[model samples]
Target: MNGGILHALLEFAFYYPLVMSLIWMSGGIIYFLRWERREPSRVRPRPLPDYPMVTLVVPCHNEGAQVRETIAHLASQQYPNFEIIAINDGSTDDTGAQLDQLMDQYPALRVIHMSSNQGKAMGLRAAALASRADFLVCGDGDALLDDYATHWMMMHMLESPRVAAVTGNPRIRNRSTLLGKLQVGEFSSIIGLIKRAQRVYGRIFTVSGVIACFRKSALHDVGYWNTDMVTEDIDVSWRLQMRHWEIRYEPNALCWILMPETVRGLWKQRLRWAQGGSEVLLRYTTRLFKWRQRRMWPVAFEYVMSLLWSYTMSVIILLWVLGCFMPLPPSLYVDTLLPQWHGVVLGAICLLQFLISLLVDRRYETRIGRNYYWMIWYPLVYWLLNTATSVVALPKAIMKRRGTRAIWVSPDRGLR
Candidate 1:
């Protein structure tokens, strides 16, 4: 192959990835514009006949160290007519004992101990069955909710009776290490952008499991969480939407979750999330075009495209790297050719968008310093890390050999 042809092929290869990124960025911008224009005041609160009974359910497995603090936080909620139920899903540690101690201190608290580990879905199922409340507030045992978290979530639900579920913001509680800081930035950009998009579309794609409120009737309508899939949260969200039920994103309702402090820990946690997401896509792929509602189609398309893009971009990155090292045939090179000017322009756009995301992060409560230099470097490093994870997850999820059934790995615990 001639040098010119090889260069052309390399350039074309670059354009494919650039195009994907551009599409994502464009969608993100549209989402932001729509979200900014939304009038929060216009969405007036509905006067509830009474403070509906709420059951705050915490599903735990080998999270003994964090259970007490989590329970204490739930017990501290200012909301009236609420119960705190902590389901210990067969914790090998002293989680049962910790819950027992809390039960004695707070009579409103209830504990359910399982003989064996049955993952979060089963734990939540058990907790929901035990509670005799009008609403269910499901959260992780390692999560800490803000004082007004439940109140705001309930208000949102009341305001939008069509909404089957309400999801709150999940902020990183541990940003002491470099890894943690990068995660904070990544989460702020990705989740923040997605939530804004969801608000605009009036269809939330997935409710963060860290803290979400669900109408008991909605769960019953959709048949609750699917224990078969690894990502029950996402599965349940899709099911709710399929039933013509609405889901709301409440930024004011806040919950803090611990991020993985170490690189290894972070990788494992991401693997489970990525794999679970893919599984949800696979399980619901058929429902994509079948759903009669227009809202459901867009949400389904977004999720399917996201998964495909992740794996496709990973392949493009690898091809680009190989093209740089090995001599390729002229035909292959030309087919993948991208212009240098396009690369420069695309790179600048990505950098600019990333900066905007960083600014959004600053608006939120972050422990990291608000330095311009640090923010610039943070996004680049975080993007690289995310790309690497997506690359690894592509194959791991394909093999269906990764992820754990045991709930011992608690990334949220370290955040507190």
Candidate 2:
């Protein structure tokens, strides 16, 4: 009996990862098919008789070194009727002095100095209150926007009155290290593909906080930036969507931001994100399942299932690691193990899915002119890092009490 139980555990351990790999590969195939079917024509341009008033709100905390460059980038945006507002969230560094200098340099730039660190949610709320623009672009101090990014985003929102918010495509600004190369893959494969899926399915899970534009009216409707959750962006996106507001994904509107160059940094960043996602799920789980809001259930279901799935993967990996040293019973192995031919069939399907992902990423990266070599090791490096983070994050999220906040940790910005 003991040997039978051990064999059953070992079989579950070995095959579960393979099952997850198949599911991920299947998702990749679906994304590729969608990409192939998408229209190739450019988004039509619409003339605006009067450009809407735009406010670019940047939240800063201990970002003295990079805040000036971010301000300069915002100041240089080509939009004629936009104001740049930088909110200093009680920085203990020279961030205030740096902002003061920049404020003096550009009359259009405004700075709001907080006496002590109140977190990003408070800073964003304060900045929104200070601004008088119809549309607000919230950004981090380390993020740099493309010259035409605001123009493209605003045009999309203006043309489509129903679009309550726009999410920018965040690309790695510095890719000098292997970790950075892996992150490039992460953005293209995992993050980018998920965003495309969400769009196709008419349900976006979270808007990237690094750079996202929200209509002021929608902000008011949903109650701007709830401070209770660590991930205010995720919470707010769900809030807007629940209220029947449309969120659009603008892949061409680019924002350059630094990605973690080390495993430790990446782990911390994803931990915070995972925790925030859990908070959002808890806060909105009831609304997510209501009969009137049935359409939004799939989005919430995906997130919940993903969180549970990560925990399962961690357990399976742990079991597999232990199983390698132990002998398994013949009966259990015979029952659970796939036939050799079946294994070969599954392997071929996985290979085909991986190839499809590679081809799609390659085509997208080629148009953007990034190095193609980065795509080769992406499946190993990027996917493993994600799985590891999810394993760590999901547990912390569940065990930790609500109201545990994570302050903004700047990514490795040495190159920038």
TM-score of each: 0.83, 0.83
User: Which ranges in model 2 have alpha carbons more than 4 Å from their true place?
Assistant: 1-49, 325-370, 403-406, 414-416
- How well does model 2 score by local distance difference test? 0.73
Give lDDT for model 1.
0.71
Best by lDDT: 2
Instruction: Report the poorest 10 consecutive residues by lDDT, candidate 1.
Output: 36-45
Candidate 1 segments whose C-alpha is farther than 4 A from its true place: 1-49, 291-293, 321-325, 331-373, 378-385, 391-416
lDDT by residue for model 2 (224-270), tens:
88876778899889999999898877665678888777777776777
Quote the lDDT for 191 in model 1.
77
Model 2: clashing residue pairs? none
Relative to the true structure, how large is the alpha-carbon lDDT of every model? Answer: 0.71, 0.73
